[model samples]
Target: MPSEESEVVVVGAGQAGVAMSEHLGAHGIPHVVLERHRIAERWRSERWDSLVANGPAWHDRFPGLEFPDTAPDAFASKEEVADYFVAYAEKIDAPIRCGVEVTSVRRHTHRPGFRVETSDGTIDARFVVAATGPFQRPVIPPVVPDGAVPVQIHSSGYRNPEQLPEGAVLVVGAGSSGVQIADELCRSGRRVFLSVGPHDRPPREYRGRDFCWWLGVLGLWDLETPPQGAEHVTIAVSGARGGHTVDFRALAADGIELVGMTRSYEDGVLRFAPDLAANIALGDGKYLALLRAADAYVERNGLAFPEEPEAHVLGPDPDCVTDPRLELDLAAAGVTSIVWATGFATDYSWLEVDAFGENGRPDQRRGVSREPGVYFLGLPWLSRRGSSFIWGVWHDARYVADHITIQRGYLAHGTTDRPGLTPASGNN
Candidate 1:
């Protein structure tokens, strides 16, 4: 196959890829964005039909565009989010080619650049930016016994309640997605059994403001530290009713049976760990710590915000852990569906180069990979917590675009450390 050349080649046409392409465009830098499917394919198809943004639309803006006429506090639907990216790409004239899957990206041995192998052809680009967002593959645990359930679906495959089986549903992993799915199932008059996990549950509204608003004000998005250990606690939130709280307690109150952590599924039976109380306490502790940290930031910064009122109905009592039936017979319980809302995995197998660390993730400092001319974006804590969000990648995208432009001259002419090679300056 013939090879096409560009100044920069970005993989994945999601929010991060679009942002990177936009910045490169703005800077008069030549680049092309390659997508495996249509633009924003994940948002277009992976999410449930009734899904909406966990955060308000106003805060989800890219650098040069905002969801026009969207209320500051209103949440956007998945389709709208997907459409926004399409419109943004058109607005910025992003050089994006859809249905082009990148097979591999490796450094050019004979040149100061990279050779990107794609389904369409090969791309000989001076720089390559991997904007494939953090969640590349859905992670359903192997403990889920095969053929134990009649129907098994990952949360990404779930669409709406009407699409599910007629009986009860078992939702594993009680993070934001799990809770939201359970809530929808309960509201749809389906019995929902939610397996609880240690996840953060910030109240939807706190001290007369949205929790996300407080997070923004308190600079939680600016947090640079990644979650320690294998258990990375994701934000447990919901975009239902514009924006609301979705937690295990709320799900339980909504008639969804709260169960302990899932252990194993064998012989038509599902088993749960007996650590229900401990899990609830762990989640509540994290929630309380978040509130305290926000308050501390306000006090230290001397920022004037509404004073937090006396504790109200924040969450369910931690000790109110119900010792429900730990072992559930799949057939006897009439549980016809299982939705695995169990997080995702970062797959860099297509990169075709050794760039990961002991953690099996790219060993990069803020998107600047160790491999010359190779970069990464749209990763959690790539620079800050926001790096994985829609509004956040602009920072890292701008930085990477700048880096690419700075090294463009050197890559083209085999020059090194030559002074006064300023990047193509445009909007910052």
Candidate 2:
């Protein structure tokens, strides 16, 4: 096999990988970006046709890159978002090799670096950055029993209502993906049954402004908390609803049946946790907690922000859980399809190192892995709440670039280290 070499190797050509390459380029470092598919392939292949960005384009700009001036505030469609990523890569002239899938990554024993094997060939690098993204693998519940219904697709495979068969659809896991898809299905004249789970329900527009903007203003985006904790649960917000809270009660009122967390799928009958009402109440409570925190901050700072109307709540239904209808029969309910929006699992199986801990995660300070010369990027809460988003990835990306430069003894060139870009061996 042909061999290649670079000072740094970045896997994936999505926004995160692009950002890492940009930073490396700015530092005059020789690096190559490898992508298994086209740039921003998820946006092009995985998302629904009608899906738009959860926030305005302004919230999605990367470091040293901004959304087109023409569509600054508009919600970018999936295609538009993909185009933006491609354009950014081209505009920066990033050294990206598309259609190159990295098959394995392992320590280079002969030297201080990594040996990366890819579909195209092999490459050795002094440093390897895994920019494969937070959503690497679709997570279907293990309890979803054998011999499931005829049509079962992860949200990653779902495109639009036309693709689904006639009759009701059971959307498992009501996170952002589940709620959004369920809402769309319901609106498109399909009877939708949504299985509720532990999720956060934040209003799209808390006051007159978007929820993201409020988070940015409150310095929540700058939060550098670690990833593991009790409060760690998959977030549930609606992008299709213009970043609005996906009110379960409202969804229930819209003729969408809301069931508790999925328990089992045996013999064509699906069991639920029988805690639908309680789970919804907890989510609503979290929303209120967020609202109260923001309110307190505004009052303490004496900011002159105008008040919006009181929040609209679709109060709970006590009978939802008590009813024996929590058990769903796939054939009898007329459910023809099941869309699992059950979140993603981070799989580093291809990495030929014991970098993972007992928790199945790499031991790293920020993006710097314990195994020197390896780094992680585009992970949620890696450095901040925005660490996984396009706008926030710069924080971790810059840090990784600086660390690589320092390891290469080029930090003195003043090329990689800016005031805040110094390599952080500790949590900020």
Candidate 3:
């Protein structure tokens, strides 16, 4: 294999990698971005056909680069989002190598930096950025036994209602993806059952502003972590059908059956947790909390935003919450397909560094790792709540780039006074 060298090697040419390259180039840093496929490959391929970005175009993009002719509040479709990234890479002249996959990264045995092994060749660099964002791996829980459903697919594999087998469908997971898919399937005339779970239900638009806009103005996007006891809760909001508030009551009223969290499947029977009512209550509490915060902010600032009474209304509990079905016979229910929208997992097995904690996640402050030249990007809560968002990735990339520049400067000046490069820390 051929060998090359650069000051930095960025693994993954998605938003984080591209942003990193842009900021690094601006700092006169020599680096190369390696991607397994085309830029924004996940956005182009992994997402379902009808998917749109969760945030509005104006807020979801990198600074100064608008989605072409897109409405400020409109959520860009998956293709449009991917194309925007491709265009951004081109405009920045990013040194990205498509089709090059990083197989492994480890400390160089005979050098001070690191060695990155790739499908194409080897690259020795002083710093390595694991810009592989989250969603590296799809997590389909083993709740269903083998051959339990005639057809099964993760949310990533889902394309459209037409791609599914003709019958009732069960979407197991009530996150944004699960709810959106369930709604789509139901509207397409297929009987749909949504396996509800712990989630935060926020109105898509509130008080004449998008929920994302409210988060931004309220500084909630910068929250370092989830509120107590709500760490594992997913947000159940949607950009589908021109964006609307996600109300389980409304979904149930519209003919989509709602059920409790799935527990297991065996002998053609599926079991569910009896926490449907509790889960709905949890989400409602979060929603009300958000509304109260917004209302308080408005009162404090004396902003004359019209009061939304509907935002405070929680419609009657659907049957799923009032008297939930704890079990179902798959065959009797005629469910032929199952879509697992249970979320994603990270794969850092290729990284041969002691940067991960006991939880198997990178232990880093911001993007800086204890492992000297290694850094992580595009993980949720890396620096803030929005760290994994498109615009958030750019901010994080700039921070990482600035940190790298400072480290290089220290080395050039023969100084180890910086906190990350202190002599006792072993880099010296």
Candidate 4:
């Protein structure tokens, strides 16, 4: 309200949004980043007490900075990462309006600006960057029966393993989130049980170098099969879901018991289907698809690949999914804790746009929306494999910011032809 016109309005001051904030600052762009909570508050508040980032500290840092060598290979705890982000904000002086919740964004029919509404008030801006990460919405399956227990929580809500109930804890979803939590629990002398589902494979070192380097080379973050669509079916890479990660191996090392995928849960009991590998198969297929895609891309781009991968392609968790049935007596086990790291859902209700196809995602290329001046960043594989992750944000941010800068420069210099200047996105 104070200024009827502004340069840009960015939503969500997390990793993605914050990266944009830094780039905008470097160019002296007068923009505001609207965040519901303090910068990186989610990392500080939501992660498990003992949880460290799965990736090492070297690759996990945000743009414009690096973690001290003292930081562990696993990176510091969630709290440390949060603190680093907070410190980053201060150094960059990103214009962040913390505690301001964004409600909606609608276009101004008369101009290039968008009318953005927030908890405090509304503003109009010429451009918008949705740095909001894709996992804003948590995916909770609806297979649970009524009154299963009083303490059901998603991985997002879990801050410490001590919060879970005592006895044999049954963790659902064998993805990285679930597996990591299970590893933590078992390592801490807790008898943990994990409901094995479809999962990703593990890699030794990606290519001839570290695994992170390989992810960059393969364009994992850059590759995305629309969550749904023809792209979902045809372009969907098998390796998308289950790329190399520490899952079953970690479980084996930690001595955690793996359970079959639960088909249904009722009356404090979880039931498994006859086919056990059903879930595991899905996970494997996605991972394989991704690996194949990466291989094809390397071949297509004429990029040389290293010799064969040293790691073996893991098949399934110890508990085979081919069996007919099994059950988990949560009540009897006195199991208290459950971590659902299965995956995420996109809740874009606040974004009113017709561009979103049936898949509920705005059809765009490289964050350039079908709608003018509306851009997206930090989406998983938005341009390439690392696009949304810490190591990748800077690359994407520079492209978008440079494009914006060029556009501004062009307009100022009185260019006769007005081309839609977008950031140059090279998946290098």
Per-residue lDDT tens digits for candidate 4, residues 1-428, read: 44354687889888877788888888887788999988877787766666665566766787467765434344456677777777788888888889998889887764456788888887877778887877777877887743576566788887666777665676777755677677667876888777765445434234444455556656454565434432311111111112335545346546676667667877778886544456555555665565565567667888777645433366445533334338877778777666676567677788775557677786677777777667788876677656767768777887788777776665445334556532222000
Per residue, candidate 2 scores C-alpha lDDT tens digits across 255-368 of 888898888877889988877877787788878877877788778989787775467444646455446256888899898899999878787887887577789887887798
Clashes of 4: 25
For candidate 1, write residues 324-415 as lDDT tens digits: 65898989999999999998998889887666787888989889988777899998889987888888897889988888777765444523
Total backbone collisions for each predicted model: 0, 1, 0, 25
Candidate 1 collision pairs: none
lDDT of 3: 0.89
Q: Lowest-scoring 10 consecutive residues by lDDT in candidate 2?
A: 419-428
The superposed Cα distance between candidate 1 and the true structure at residue 271, in angstroms, equals: 1.2
Model 3, C-alpha of 326: deviation from truth (Å): 0.3
Q: Please identify model 4 stretches exceeding 4 Å from their true place.
A: 1-4, 69-74, 204-209, 217-255, 274-325, 406-428
lDDT at 200, model 3: 91
Best by lDDT: 3
- At residue 186, what lDDT does model 4 achieve? 82
Give the per-residue lDDT digits (tens) of candidate 3, residues 306-414: 9998789886887767999999899999999999999999999999998999899899999999899899999988899889999999999999999998888766664
- The numbered model that scores best in TM-score is 3
Positional deviation of residue 283's Cα in model 1 after best superposition, in angstroms: 2.0
